[model samples]
Target: ALIAAFEARIRAQPVHVAAEVQLAATAAALPPLSAPVDEEAEAPAEEAIAPRAPQEQVRVRADLLDNLVNHAGEVAIYRARLEQQLGAFRAAMAELDRTNARLRDQLRRLDLETEAQIVARYQREQDSADPTFDPLELDRFSTLQQLSRALNESAADLTGLQGVLDDLARQYDVLLQQQSRVSSDLQDGLMSARMVPFDSVVPRLRRVVRQAGHDTGKQVQLRLDGTHGELDRNVLDRMVAPIEHMLRNSVAHGLETPAERVAAGKSEEGTITIALRHEGSEIVLQVSDDGRGLDRDAIRRRAEQRGLLKPGAVLTDTELDSLIFEAGFSTSEQVSQLAGRGVGMDVVRNEVRQLGGTVEIHSVVGRGVTFTLRLPQTLAVTQAVFVQIGETTYAVPVASVSGIGRISRERFESGTGGYRYAGEEYALHDLGLLVGQGPAKAEGQAQVPLLLVRAGDLRAAVAIDQVVGNREIVVKPVGMQIASVPGIYGATITGDGRVVVILDVAPLVRRHLAQRPAAEAEAQQQRHVPLVMVVDDSLTMRKVTGRVLERHNFEVVTARDGIEALEKLEERVPDLMLLDIEMPRMDGYELATAMRADARFRGVPIVMITSRTGEKHRQRAFEIGVQRYLGKPYQELDLMRNVYDLLGIARARD
Candidate 1:
C-alpha cells in the first residue's frame, strides 16, 4: 500500500527525485535474511520490492519412510534366524544326550536282571542231588530253567534297542552343532551389512563446531580420528542432531572464551579430540576437550540446594557425574535450545544405550573433560577372552592386555608407598585385594599372575591366574546387564564350551584405577627401562635383535652399517652389546677389542654377536669375556631376555 501511495505521489513530484528513487529501489530489491543484518536491512526502499516466500515442508512419499522402517526391521530378521537355529540345535543336542543316557541305563538294567536269573538256575542245579528225595524238587528245577531262558532273551532284546538309540543320538548331536555354526556365521554377515561409516553422520557437523564457536565469539579446534569406524546405517543417519547438540554445548558451555582460555595458558583455539576404535565386542568412541572440566563440587551444591541430594551424602565421582544426565538439569535459561536442557544428553544417552551401548564421563580439574561412549560392533565376530566367573564361563578380549606377570604375597605391597624396579619406581595395586575373589586355598605362598592394560594412553597392571589364548567369538549381547558393568563389551562361548565375558579395555582399565590414589596414576616409564641402541652391519641381524629386546619392553634402536652404528654409539650407549663378524668399516673381533681399549665404553657389555659355522669365534670371544656369546639369528627371546636380566630389568612387577 505504501509503495502504491508513493508511486502516485512521485508522479505528481519533480522528475529528477522520482528517477533517483526508482533507480535505487531497482538495485536494493528484497533483503537476504541469513546472518544478522545491519542498517542495510531496514533502510528505505529505493524501488518496489517483495518479501521472500516461506519454506515448504517437503512432503515425503509414504513409501520412503516405510522403506526406512522396513530396513530397520531387516536387522531383526538375522537376529531371529540366529536365535532360532541356535536354540533349536541346542535343544536337539540336549535331547540326544538324554536319550543316549536313558538307553545306556536301560541296557545295564537288563544285563543285571539276566545275570541274576542265570545265577539262580546254577545254584538250583548244584543242589539237585538233595532235591531227588522229593517229587516237588523236580518241578522247582524245571521252573528255574524256564526263568533263566526268559531272562537271557529279554536282555538280548534290550541290547539291540540300545544300540539303535545310540546311533540316532550321535547323528542328532552332530547335526545340531553344524546348525549352530551356520547360524552364527549368517548373523555375523548380516550385521556387517548394516554398518555405516561414522563420518557420514558428522561430515557437515564438523563445520558446525567451528561455526558455533564463531557465532559465540569463542575459539575452538576440532580433531577427529578413526572416523572410518562404522555404526548401524539408520542410527548413523539420526546421529547428527544429538552430536551437533553436544558440539554446541562444548563451544558454548564446555570451552572457555578466547580471552579466558588464553589466560589459563591454553591455546586460543581450544582443542576437541574425537576418536573411535573397535574394542572386543563394541566400537568405543571418545569426544574430549582441553577446556574447563565438570565442576563436581558446584554440581553437588546445586543438587543439594535443589533437594536433588540429601545433606552429607557420600557419593562417588561416577555417581556425581551422572547428575548431568538427569532430566531438566539445565540451569542456563538465556542459552539457546541446542543443549543443556538436561534433556538433550539424556535423549542421546537413551538412544545410544537402547542400541546396546553406554555413555561415561571423565574429567581433570585443570586440564579437560572426556565423554566416553561404547557401542557394540553388532555385525562382526568379536574377539573375546572366555573365563569362568562363579558357575558360568565368560570371555575377555586380548586387546585389553596391559602385560602378564606373577606376584606372590611376599612381593605384594600396600597401595600407598611407591615400589622400586630396574632403578625406577611404580605404584602398585594388589590384585587379590581388588577382586575380592583371590583363591579358596592357595598353595606354595600367595602368588598370582598379572596383566597390564592401557586406557586412554594410561596403563595399569592387573593380576590374573591364567592367560587364555586369543579367539574370534560371535558376540551375544545381554540386555540391562551391559549397563551395570563398566568394562564389559559382550559375552561369547569358547570352543571348549565355556562362556567368556569380553572386557572393554577402556572402561575396565579406567574403572580399575578410578578409586585408587593419585600416585597410581604415575607414568608407566617408571616400570619400563630406557631404550637400548644396537648396531650391526647385517640387515637380518639388526631386525632380529631389535624384535627380541622390544618384546621384553626394552625399547630397541638399531643401525645397519658401521658408519651409522658408530654415530648411534656416539649419541647413546646401550645396556649391552652384540658385536657381529665380517663388517665393512669394522669386524666383530675389531669392534670388541676397540671397545675394551676405549675408556668411555670399557664398562659396556659386549657379547659375541656372530654366526661362524665354527667354534673359532667362541674361543676368541671368551678371551675378551666382556660379555656372553650368541650366534646369528639366535633364539630371539633368549638373547634379549638375557640382556634384560643382565640390565636388572627382567623381574616381574607386583
Candidate 2:
C-alpha cells in the first residue's frame, strides 16, 4: 500500500519517475547485510538497558542560544588569520621569477585533480541516457582544482621568504589544535552551563492540571521537585510535550472522578506527582497519580491481537510494561484529544530513544500508573568506542556499546533488501556498502567483527572490520547542511584537529525505517535476520575471500565473470559490491571504465579490490570516482579502517 501510494505520487511527476525508479532500483539491488543484532549475554553491564529511574532535578534557562557566542568568536579568529594570509600572499608575489618551478608543481597537482573531476563528470554524462547534457560542451573548471593549485603555489613561494613566519604558521596550527581542544571543552561546559531548571517545564504544566479539575469534574493536585539541577539545554527543549502528555493521561485516564472516590470513602482530591532526581550518569523523570493503574491484561490482549505478542506467550513484568510503546496499542478505554487515538506515547518513546535514553512503566492495581523516563546526564560530550565493519569503520558510544561477536553467515539467509541473523531477523546494512565504498583495508575477508550498541530497549549489531580503539570526543552539531547522513548524531573533534561526528543510532535506525514501508518495518520489529552481499571478483583476497563476510550472516555472492555478474546483479543487487582488476574479456579497469559510463550502474562502488599494484590503475579509478582503494591480497583486519577513511566509521580515534 505504501508502494502503491508512492507509485501514485510518482506517476504524477514525469520528471521524478526516473529518479523514483532509480531509487527503487537501488533498493532492489541491495543484498542482505549481515545481521549481528542480538543481545549479548556476556556484554558489559554498563551497556545493558537500564530500568526507569526516579526523576532528576535540572536547571534550565531561556537564553541557551546566547552560549553559541563562542562559536561566533571562532569565526572571527579564523577571519583575522585569513586576513594575515592575504597580506603574505601579496608580498610573496614579488618573487615569482625565483619560485616559478614550485608553483608549477602545485599547479600540476591541482590540474590532475581537476582533470579527474572533469573525467568524473564526463563519466556521469556518458552513463546517463538523458541526451541533454553534452560533456564536451560543458567544461566546468573545478573550484577544488583551482584552490589546490593556488595553495600549492602559495606554500612554495612562502618557503624562501621567512623561516620565522613559516615556523609561526606551523606553531599556529599547533595552537589551533590546542585552541580547538579548548573550544571543545568549553562547548561541553557551555552545554552544561546553559541548562535551565527542570522545574520550568512543570509550572507551565501545573496550570493544565488545574484546568483538568474543571473539565473532567475530578479533584486533582499536582506537585513537582528537582528544578535546581542543570541539564543540557537541548534536552530540555524536547521535554515539554512528553511531560504534558503524561500529565494529561494521568488526569483523563488514570484518575477516578469525585463520585468514585466518594463511593470508596476516599478523599475527593486526587494526587499526581511529577518527580525528578539524578542517579550516576542519568537524569530520571516520573509521572504518578493516586488513581487506577494500567491494566496489564488489557495491554497484553491488545498486543496479542495486533500480533505484537505471541498468543499465550509468557513474559516478564518489564517486558509486559514495554508493550504500550508498540504503535497502535493504547490502554485508554476511549479516545480523547490527549491520547488513545494511538499515537502519543510511542512518539515520546522514540524521542527519548533518539537522545540515547529509555522509558518504562510500573503500576499497582489501586494506586496508580507511574511512567518513568531516563535521560543522559550532561548530553554535551561522551566517550565512544570506535569499531569497523567490513572495510568501513564507525564510532559507537562507549555508553551504549554492549559487546562484540562474530556470527556464522552459513546460518543466515537473504529475503528482499535485508537479512536474518540469529533466530531473530535484522536488516543487515553493510557499513562499508551503505556509506559508499569498501573500507580502507577491511575487505571483511576474514571472520566479520560485530559490535553491539543499544538504543533504548532495542539492541542493534553494527558490522565492521575492526576496532580502531576509543576516544573521549566533544559532541558538536554537524550543522544543518549534512545532518541527514545516517549513523551521525553530531560532530566532535578528536584530540587532534580533526572533527568526527558523534553517532546517533536512533536516527540512523529511524532513517532506515523512513526508507521502508510499514510492513517491512514490522518484519524488522520481529527478531528476524538479513543477508548482505560482497560482489568483488577476487576469489582469495581477504575482503572477498571465502566466508569471511559470511561469518557475520551475510549471504555472500561471487561471480567469476562480468556477464554472469551482471545477471546475478539484475537478479539481485547486493547491499554492496567490491570489484577487482585484470579479469578475462572484462578487465576490472575496463569494467569500471564502462560501468561508470552506464546509467544503470552509476552509484555502485566498483572498487578495484585487487592487487592492481600501480599508480595509474588507482589514479584512473579515482578519475572515474571509484569509492576507495586497497592493495591486493587484502586482510580482513584492515577492512573497517579503510571503510572509516572512505566513510567516517573510525574517524574519532586517537
Candidate 3:
C-alpha cells in the first residue's frame, strides 16, 4: 500500500518519477512477509548459537606487567638471602655437634678419674687396718656421683634435642628448595611475558629504510635475518630510534649513487643487512652495508680541522675511526638534508650506552662498514659480579667480564700502568679510583685481584680489593640527575639489602684508552724520583715532614692517617714511610705491622717518630719492622741521616 501511494504521488509530480520507479523495483525484489520457515533451519540455528569458548589471551597494561616482574625479582632476592641464612645455620649445627662430642669425651674422663680416686681411698682405708672398712662403702653415693649422673642425663636430653633439630633443618631445607623453584618459575614467566620478537619492529625499520631511500634518490634493499629472536619490550622500544638513525645514515652516507655504483663495477641497487642474535647473555645486533667504506684519511682531515687532533698526531686506523662519534664531528663539506649537522652517530652511541650496551664499528677501505651493538638481554634482572673496591661493594655485569685472576707486583708494569691478560696487554685501572673512591688497596698481599673486562673491541684489567662473588640483581635506573655519569650504568639492591652501583664496562674501557698516553707520560717523567709517604694526624707535622722530604728532592705524598696512606700506596709504592704513632683510623704501629705483613711493602723502610717515648713503645715499633724510632723534637740531622741510610742514598752536600 505504501509503495502504491508513493508511485501515485510520483506520477502526479513527474520530476520524481525515476526515484519512484527504482523504489518500486527494490520492493518487488523482496520476499513476501508471509513466507514459511523450514524446521531444519531452526535446528541448525540452535547448534550455531551454542556458547563460544572463553578467550585464551587477555590484554594487560604494560605498567602492571612491569610491577609483577619487579615483585618476582624481589622474590628471587629474598630467596637468595634465605639460602645464605640456611647455609650459616647448617655450619652452626655442625659446630654444635662437634662441641657435644668434646663434652662427652671430657665427662667420660671425669668418671674414670672418680673411679681411680675411690680405688685409692679404699686401699688407704685397708692399709690403715680399720676392721669396719668395707668395699661396699666405696660404692656409696656422694655429691660428685649425683652431679655426674645428672650431667649424663642432661647430655642424653641434649642429644635427643639435636636429633629433633636435625630433622627440622632437613624439612626447612626441602621447603626452601621448593620456594626457590617456584620463585624461579615466576620470574621466568614474567620476563617471558615482557619479551617480543625482533620482527615486531621490522616493519617500522623497513618503512624508515624505504623513506630514506626515497629521500636520497637511491635504490636500496634492506635484508633482515633472525626475526624470531626476542628481546625485552622496553629494550626493543628504546633501540628503535638508534636503529632508524643508523639506517638513515647508511642510506645517505654509506650507499653511493646509482651511477657511481655502476662506475665502481657494482650493482645499481645497494643492500643493507640487519641481523639479530643472542650471544651468551647479550643481544648482538649487526647493521652492515655493501657500499664504499669509511674513509680514514677523510676522518683524520676532518678531526684536524676541528682541532680534535694535532696536525701530525699519530693514530691507528681503529683510533682514527673512533673520532667520528665525537659530538659535532663531521666530514661532510656542507649541510644537507641528512648527512651534515654532525649529530646522529654520537646520539646513537649515547643511546646504546644508556641501555648498558657497547657499540663497535668495523670498516674496510673498499668493502663496507658494520656497526655492532652488544646489549643486555633484559634491563630487568641480570647476573652480575660483586667486587669490593674499598669499603663499598659494586656490581659489574657478568657479560662484560671475560676473566678474573691475581697479578703480582712483578707482573704489573708501574711505568706503563698496565698488565698482561690473555696474552694481550691492557691498561690496569684501580676500580676504586675509577669510581672516585680512591685507589683500591691490596689486602696485605702483593698479588692483587684483577678482573679482565671487555667492551666491544676495548679491554682492560681492573684491580679491586676483593671479589665478593656473583648474584642475580634487579636493575634500577639511577634517575635523571646521575644518568649521564660515565661508567655507572644503574643501581641495584643486593640480597643483603645494600644498594650497589652497577658499573658500565664500556665507558670505563674507553676512558682508560683515552687517558693512557698522558698517564704513561707522567709515569715516565716521575720514574726517577723516590716517593716518600708521610702519614700523620697533625696538619703541622704532615706539612713539616713533607717539606723536609721535598727539600731533599724526594717526591712526597702525605696522608692524614694510615688508611689514607694505604689508599695512596695502591697508586704508587713509596720508597720509605715516615709514620706518626698516634693517628685516627689507623695508628703508626698498626700501619707498620700491616706494611710488614704485605709482600709489596714488607721491604719498605719505616721510620716512627712520636711523643710516646716509652721503652715499650720503641720495642713495639722495632718489632713491627720500623727501621728507625725517633721521639718527638728529633734533630733534623739525625732524621735525615736515618732516612738516607734506610733508602741507601747519598747525603746532600752541606
Superposed on all Cα atoms, model 1 deviates from the true structure by an RMSD in Å of: 28.1
Residue lDDT tens for model 3, 1-654: 657877888879998788888888888787776779788988878778995687799799999999999888778777777777878788678757865776687788887877677676677767665567565464665688678878878888888888998998999999999998888888999999999899988999999999999998999999988868999999999999999989988888889999999999999999999999998889999999998989888899999988999999999777888898899987777788678889888998888877878888999865789999989899999889999965589999987888897888556536355767778666677675566555556644668898888775677888888899987788887887887777888898766677899998667656756776665455445324577888887766877888888888887888878898999888778889899988767988888888889998898999998999999999988877888999898888898999999988888689
Best by lDDT: 3
What is the per-residue lDDT of model 1 for residues 188-279, given as tens digits with 9 covering 90 to 100? 55555566688775668778887888788887888989988887665565556667777777776688888888899888888888888977
lDDT of each: 0.61, 0.63, 0.83
Number of backbone-clashing residue pairs for each candidate, in the order shown: 16, 63, 0
Best of the two (1, 3) by lDDT? 3
lDDT of predicted model 3:
0.83
List the lowest-lDDT window of 10 residues for candidate 3.
519-528
Regions of candidate 3 where Cα sits further than 4 Å from its true position: 1-55, 126-139, 390-392, 413-425, 436-447, 466-468, 479-485, 506-654
lDDT of candidate 2?
0.63
Candidate 2's TM-score reads 0.45
Error of 1 at 490 (Å): 15
Off by over 4 Å in 1: 1-144, 234-240, 296-301, 310-320, 339-342, 379-654
TM accuracy, model 1: 0.41
